[model samples]
Target: MNVLVIGKGGREHALVQKLSESPMVDELYAAPGNAGITEATCVDIVETDIDGLIALVHSKDIGMTIVGPEAPLELGIADRFHEAGLKVFAPTQKAALLEGSKSYAKAFMQRHEIPSAAYATFSDPEAAKDYIQAQGVPIVVKADGLAAGKGVVVAETTEEAIEAVDDMLVNKRFADAGATVVIEEFMEGKEFSLMAFVNGKDVYPMITARDHKRAYNQDKGPNTGGMGGYAPVPDVSAEDLTFSYEHILQKTADGLIAEGRSFTGVLYAGLMMTQEGPKVIEFNTRFGDPETQIILPLMKNDLLQVFEDVLAGKDPELEWEDQASVGVVLAANGYPEAYKKGMPIPQINGNVYTAYAGVAGTDEQLVANGGRVLLVGAKNDTAPEAAKTVYQALKQIDNNTDYFYRTDIGL
Candidate 1:
């Protein structure tokens, strides 16, 4: 069957690569794919161009379309595809609200009795400031709407919290996305990413991964989409995994069904393994970027088959390799903030696998086209070993001052 994967990022690159390896997929295509996706034929249609995508699907006789990013999903691309009598793998706009709006997600968690941080929502800047003042410091401030993963601020001081509120509500830093904000009590614990192929009550969880959201080493700097990540995190216990699967993923699937929003795509739970147990920090309705770059390589099942089975309401009986995998992002020097683009990217060689994001191909070389250029991933017997291999490959890229990556990913 011919398949089309939507979006233009490392996550979409991973999906294209994995789906290309599937015998079930006769032809694989990516919409507005970046320079690094070599396995699939890249198309020029933007992900949000719903009419263009539907027309392309018809013209190419594409059998299935898999969404890789949240923007297109939130725009109701899936619904558009369905209306055109095309098969798509993604959630509707209403279901995508779980990730599109922080306030909505928090309310959903509260309504379903799902474990999460205590929170309050506010649209008025003064009211938000007052709430932060009363709650004290070390709280989380989030833009109610999507801000491309930069909406969250884990403030350690009241001043910083108030500033974040001002940035969103007053300065309009995040634009309308921050018009409403959700402030939550800080939950202390190690965080992990758990994504599942969810079809209403039937949820098949993937192996656990830990995403390093901080941009610099030792967890310093501003939060990014993700700096790096590793799968099958050694620190997360089997019991903890079980608890997260049951209390979070399963419960969320059931809750969405009860609320008349049965999810039909990747449901990502950004979880924190607290002293009490696993609690959700946030949710994403699509595959995570760097995490997907690492996790998909360790899966033994065919990517297309897994999607087909999940969509069919049948068990895919997911299988995974015993080896661990790691991926580190190569971001523009001033990433998660303003940075230069169009800088020439050095050639990468050897065993390491790569997923290109913000890059465009040139006749001579690849150039940085966006904030995060690409991710270099490697698989090994342990997370540390995989990270070592990845860093070694990253070091091989000829000296260039245009980019930076975290030194510590899987450690």
Candidate 2:
């Protein structure tokens, strides 16, 4: 079958690589794909250019469409395709609010009795500042809408919290995404991520992967999408897993369905294990970047089949390798801040898996284009050791660019 994957990130590259391996797939194409995906035929139209994507699909006679990013899904691209009788794995616009609007998601948590953080929303800058001052230090400031996964800011002090709010509201940093803000009391705990295939009724959970969001090695720097990640997070007890499935996952599916919305495709829950229990930190409508690079490598089954089941609204069983996987993202120096691009990118060993993100230019040699350049992945007996091995393997690829990556992903 002819398939079209959307987005231009490591996650999408992983999708492209896996789908290519599936015998069920006849031809594959990616929308606005990056340098890492040059091996896979890529189109140039950006994902947010929905009209262009739709036209391409129709012209190419694409049989199936898989969305890799949340922005297009939130913008109702899936609904558009479904309306045109095209098979798509993503949910309709009405159901996408689970990740589209933070305010709506938080409100849903309250209504469904799902365990989540305490939070307040604001549209006025002064009100946000007032709320921040009243709340004291160590809070999370987030833009109400999508900001390319760079919207949320976790403040460690009261001063930081105030500045974060002002940055979003007063400074117009995030523009429309920051027009309205969500501030929540900071919950101290370890974070774990779970991405599952959901077709409204059926829920197929993938293996858990924890992300290292901090830009620096010691978890002190700013967040830049994700620096690295590992699958099958160690020490996450079975009880917490049950709580996530019973309270967070099950409740979420039932609640969305009850509200006349059927979520199809990926449901990613970013959870922080608090003292009380596992509470949701946030929800993503699709897969995680570095996380996906590792998670896809561990999946033993065909991705096209799973996506097909989602599009057909059928229950599909999911399977994954027992071994653990790890992924580390390589970024140009000064990422999540001002940095240069279009630099020459060197190649990694043929054995290690590499998925590209910020890449432009044509054919032969790939070039660095985005904040995140590529994701390095490998699988082994355990997650921690695999992470270490991946780092060692990545050391061989050299471009001399001011690249940065976190050293302690699974450690």
Q: Identify the candidate with maximal lDDT.
A: 1
State residue 215's C-alpha deviation in candidate 1, in Å: 0.5
Q: State the TM-score for model 1.
A: 0.98
Cα distance off (Å), candidate 2, residue 150: 1.2
Segments in model 2 whose C-alpha atoms lie over 4 Å from true places: 397-401
Q: What is candidate 1's lDDT per residue for 273-314, written digit by digit as tens?
A: 899988999999999878899999999999999999998999
TM-score of each: 0.98, 0.96
Candidate 2 has an lDDT of 0.85
**lDDT by residue for model 2 (40-107), tens:** 67889999898899898898888988899988988999888888888888888888888888999999
Q: Give candidate 2's TM-score.
A: 0.96
Q: For candidate 1, which ten residues in a row score worst on lDDT? A: 391-400
Candidate 1, superposed: residue stretches over 4 Å from native: none
lDDT of each: 0.92, 0.85
